[model samples]
Target: MKKYVQEATDINVWTSLKEDTFDRGKDIREFIEGLELIEGNAFISLDAKWGDGKTFFVRQIEETLKYFRAKQMETEEKLLKDLESYEYLKESVAVKETTVEHIYLPVYYNAWMYDDHNDPLMSLLLVMTKQCGGAYNTKINTKSLGERLLAVASSLPISIKKINPATIIKDLQEGKMDILSAVKTEEDIKECVRDVFNDIIVEEAEKLVVFIDELDRCKPSFAIEMLERIKHYFDDERIIFVVSLNKEQLIHTISNYYGSEFDATRYLNRFFDVSINLPEISWYQKQKVQCTNSERFWITLIADELSDYYGFSLRDKLIYKSSIESLPRDVGDAFSQDKMYLNIFEVIIVLLDMVDAKEKKAFLEGKSNILIDLMPRIEIYKKYILRSFGIDIRDDCEEKLTEKYKLVQEVYEYVFGRDTEEYFKEADISRNLKEICIKACNGLKS
Candidate 1:
């Protein structure tokens, strides 16, 4: 007997850059290295679809940068010991550079988590103020710069929850409240903020690297506000922003900010200097087509057929591959030229999610015709299966339908021999599978 459990059994959670088994960390490191060569304010967009591991990729890069910075602060003996333990650092010149110009104060902020902010400046101020303790050992007067920025942030035209600036000052105790109390015009506030920003940039020992993530998931207003604030307020050459978001979704977010009639793509282009798409993961995308032995195609075909009985199994993929290879040359030759819709590796992985241990073992061992179980649910695999044979279900003719069945039967016989028909007939499998096929054919008629 097998039981379904809700808790996670296996997961390799990566806390640092070295644990990257997916080969994603190297590309990100190259990007960071490229960014280090430039000396001006710039922007980069790490573009990828949601759930494609963008967060993990960026976290790895962040950890790598922090590790390098921490190493620079270590004694020579300690640094050598650390290098011996972490092999990836041994070949890198970026980790060895001791110049203040190459160092950065990296700050990561998740925009989606702080979208409740009525004013984007307040959220940014909170992030900047928290780092005023000079963690990077820079000579920058971060405390004074933060206070000046806060005073400017408090007087902005944007609405905040607190009304009394004096009360805000008393409660926060960050700075005096009288920096802009006498100012009447918007220009004065902007000028005050701009001056403080310039001073902060000059005062900093190293450049500021702000990584804004999940911007597309934030409210349209909040997303747009964050972009506008960074552009107008943080325009110094010493600041760099590496933002992550889906380009399409961010354009849609921009559409919500402006009307749908606007050219959102052209408008959003002003924010980023360079945009790079993450390389596609093999499991999520189709593999590149290549010439290979027909045995490979037959192997995938067996896996697909097995899917009908076993649902799916990671284990069966390996077993099926071995089983198919062990078949006589003539049987393997029959499938060599045959086409298959699913990738053998991916198909097996998908099946693993759909079956249990006992069920998978029985089916893989050839105790049953799995097709009968899967026949009634053929619609699930119908699209891909039909595609495998260069079939379009919408164009079903009598000759075409017969040809399709002939091919299916040939593959069926190769697996189960003369008992193929008898295997389907058992346990009402033939009747049920037929009914589903009839319904599918009728769908073509309608």
Candidate 2:
């Protein structure tokens, strides 16, 4: 079964996703190596946008850790029913289980919690303790973290519940302290947060990781809180924080967070030793569109769909072509030149960028109903120019637009050394725009 699911709340059910097959082998292996190191946090970005498989990768990492953790525990025979249910069992009580390959326990921190700057450091500690098969009972000391935070939890700010940070840190460390209140000092909060990670590594001897997903989704205020928390508090050697965020949103958020001091590079550099950017899918990515008797529409359509891009995928081009080409023949064999040209003209103007070529074609064909026009080889090239360009020329308009389009093609070739961007860019666009307009107006005479 696939490691992760699409839903945010439920953890039981997992759905298979196609993205797991991506061939990022070397990078994945290097990350695994980094995980094996017992000290210092490794901050790594997944390098993908919101939907391109960030969750799946996180789940995979979690599964790997859970396996290692399970293996480190003592034998099953030693885990007698009587000893199995304890809050935080001391390492002195070793399990008697046989040698296992790995453990897969991972503590996931919800990204939504980032908004509340006053979030108790204790709640997070509780989660890490649970991940280690230890319950959060009254056995840890928390006074080292302070007491003012306890008051914040009782009364909320802006209806957002604040928890005492010291309570949880002490809980993780001593597993014997029963402090119910919070301390208000920033130093106390930082100490509490850092101690949780340090205690997990030094006391429990387990790999510590913090996975923060969806930083891009939160309000700017909450987003800034999250960034600052990580920078100031979660910078422990024994802990790793994996956060997912978008660049543009992050810029806006941090700009608001730092106002005049918005330097995206500086903020990231403070904590992230290595940062990587996930790239958008390039135009060359090929996808299947349709099949016909003679050949299949198996090419990237990017170029045809977008009117003013330097380049687009074959899928885009095909999709845009469909807008005009998808027309069904007029019923009853009424193949008039005027009617066919009119149908072609309908798709040329008002270039819509968002819709895929297939959808555009469907709309035009469904609306125009001009199939017979396509089959009759009646100087369609000339018709293409007249309707596509808003130009009135004698019978040889194709000769004109084609010439114009080529001029664009020449400058493009000079700049890129080839038709790299395809029919995009202003030069080529002006010619195509005129052609489409002319075609719509029937040789500019309509």
Candidate 3:
């Protein structure tokens, strides 16, 4: 049961016994330690494919804040400087900036509304107020500076309500109650933005490390706008903006929406201070279980992870292997008959990658998008085998990339003929490129 399998035999990638979750490894520790030291805005990039547990790490931040505050969401100390997490008003910075601060707290989660970038700072201001436990006062938006303050005053005591209707109106004529003293128009609301930081510090509690998951998730048109907002108005080092981004997704979103007006990396280069890539490492449980079957189970599990990471689906590697009365002849071969009939992905990835772009595009239009996208990759692989090692056709491309690979001798015959030396270019393989190709080959193989 312990063996490598091709993608053709597999499906449903999630069922692998190998777990994918954040476990606070060395990479995470290093990144956080580095992040804690920075004084100004910075940029960091964590390279990871989807499902590699980026979100899990962000949750760790939230957990740290919870521990610092003893799980109290709104303790008076919740707004304090030393606390791990906090909330506050714009008017309180000077008092709080000495310790933990929330200068112009970022309000940057788009909830999939990536197009909402035009007024990101304004949108951010709205969200920041909410984050600090402040409610949106709808009526205040329409009122004059004095009237807005009157509204805040009106919310205070029932006594004010009792005296208000006619007398309060009369007092307004006399200019007795300066209701406008506290707050005012939209501009003034923004003016109150800095107070949130001061409030958090004076509270003498933990600092709130707020992570805005993915500003990059927003559309490119809004990306620069959003970036500018973060750069210019709402600047603070203590309030960390932890982002969860897949680089390619960020790039595609940017190019599609922004017409390549700005380089995504160059633009993003300004924000992230520290980043750590979460790798898909071996998923073996280190704790020794004395169960009799533990060794067997562990062996099978490790094989499963290796297979999955190499592009085999759980269904193909496990379920189909055990089922299907007639065993798949040459089950995991990149070009085996049973595999070709059972799953189409293996063929598709190769065809798409090797074919002319226009041809690939036309084929993609006529075929399933999944297969279309997969085909090109497969073709690049097949062509590489043909061109590099002269191992075309039945001779798999990946085998040439591996160290001491196991394969039928016929594979070599089909690829480089009897004389492997005529095409195997020793000088052509640079160490750097060799390792990369080797890993890529291994990824495709097992």
Give TM-scores for every candidate, taking all chains together and pairing residue i with residue i.
0.54, 0.48, 0.43
User: What are the lDDT scores of the predictions, listed in order?
Assistant: 0.53, 0.43, 0.38
- Write the residue-wise lDDT of candidate 1 on 1-446 in tens digits: 11211111112212223344444555766677776787788888889876555665565555456556556567667666653334554343433332323656566677887787666655665555444334444333544544554555654565544455435534333333333444566565567656654543334336767778889999988898888878876667777888988899999878877898999998888888888887755532111111123655544454546543542222233333443343223222222222231132223323443555564444333343444445335443454456555666677544664555455544443332443444443121231232222222222210
Note the clash tally of each candidate. Answer: 7, 77, 42
Q: Best candidate per TM-score, number? A: 1
How many angstroms is residue 176 displaced in model 2 relative to the true structure, after the best TM-score fit? 26
TM-score, predicted candidate 2 vs. hidden true structure: 0.48
Task: Give the candidate number with the greatest lDDT.
Answer: 1
- Which tens-of-lDDT digit does each residue in 1-446 have in candidate 3? 23322221112111110122223433444454555565554544555555444544454433333332332434565446544223322122211222222222222343244344235554454344444443211222212322333444533444543453445434443445433233345444334444444443324332334555555556665665665556554454445555567777777676666567757665465565566565544434211111112333322333333334344322233332232111222233233322322223222223334334564444334333433233234433234324434455565545463421222122222222233334433222222322222223224322
Regions more than 4 Å wrong, model 1:
1-16, 76-101, 131-204, 282-446
Off by over 4 Å in 3: 1-22, 25-28, 39-47, 71-118, 126-190, 199-202, 255-262, 273-446
Ranking of all candidate structures by their TM-score, best first:
1, 2, 3
Q: Quote the positional error of residue 144 for candidate 2 in Å.
A: 16
Candidate 3 residue 426 C-alpha distance from true site, Å: 42
